[model samples]
Target: MVRILQQKQFVGHEIHGKSHKYYPLITKETYTKSFMKGFVRRYFSGSYRQMVSFFTKEDNLSLHELEQLLKELKDKNS
Candidate 1:
């Protein structure tokens, strides 16, 4: 079965060869800064609280990782 993570752009395809492994790669276009903003908009409502809410509900995000992402977003906007 193929699983699709709506926010995380990807198709989880299986490897035909031995030692099968999968990774999430962006769908459509390359995930540049502009693309990320759109991703954030859809997933986080372009707000800090929204981002927190997203991870809380999804229960798969790490706090430290979110903090780092927040810092990066801030740096980009500033």
Candidate 2:
């Protein structure tokens, strides 16, 4: 919690009566995007394809999920 206070992007804090309260400084979507980018960079060489390939090979992605992913990609490209 103390560490979170240091990153202005992550949270804001309130001090009251010798106690501290913290609240998010960024939206959930923004934080998730930042976190996933760092995770992919650190673990998958910054390649989203490599990340998806790893999950597919590990049987982590369901067939329906894969199809949905492909559909989204196609829609994006279209």
Candidate 3:
């Protein structure tokens, strides 16, 4: 837990006596987006299409699942 606190930028803590209280410094969505962007940049050369293609081919993501994901993206954009 101490190691995680040291690594994370979006976590804040308070110390009272021997006890500690931790809170988020950012929203879950913000953290996820930042983490995923870094992951994709590091592993996929910053290409979202390359990331999706790798998952669909190597991870054996079904066509139906791919269509569902596309629908969700479209819905979000709309």
Question: Which model scores highest in TM-score?
Answer: 2
Q: Which pairs of residues have clashing backbones in candidate 2?
A: none
Rate residue 76 of model 1 by lDDT.
100
Higher-scoring candidate on lDDT, 2 or 3: 2
**Alpha carbon RMSD to native, model 2:** 1.7
Overall local distance difference test of candidate 2: 0.89
Worst 10 residues of 3 by lDDT: 1-10
User: Per-prediction RMSD in angstroms?
Assistant: 8.5, 1.7, 2.2
Return the number of clashes found in candidate 2.
0
Candidate 3 lDDT by residue in tens digits, 28-54: 899789999999999999999999999
Model 1 residue 8 distance off true place after TM-score fit, in angstroms = 21
lDDT of 1 by residue, 3-71 (tens): 544335554545677755666666455556667778778887777677677676797777887789889
Candidate 2 at 73: error in angstroms?
0.8
* Superior candidate under TM-score, 1 versus 3: 3
TM-score of each candidate structure, all chains considered together: 0.35, 0.83, 0.76
With a 3 Å backbone cut-off (N, CA, C), the pairs that clash in candidate 1 are none
Clashing pairs in 3: none
Where does model 3 exceed 4 Å of error? Answer: 1-7, 76-78
- Arrange candidates, best TM-score first: 2, 3, 1
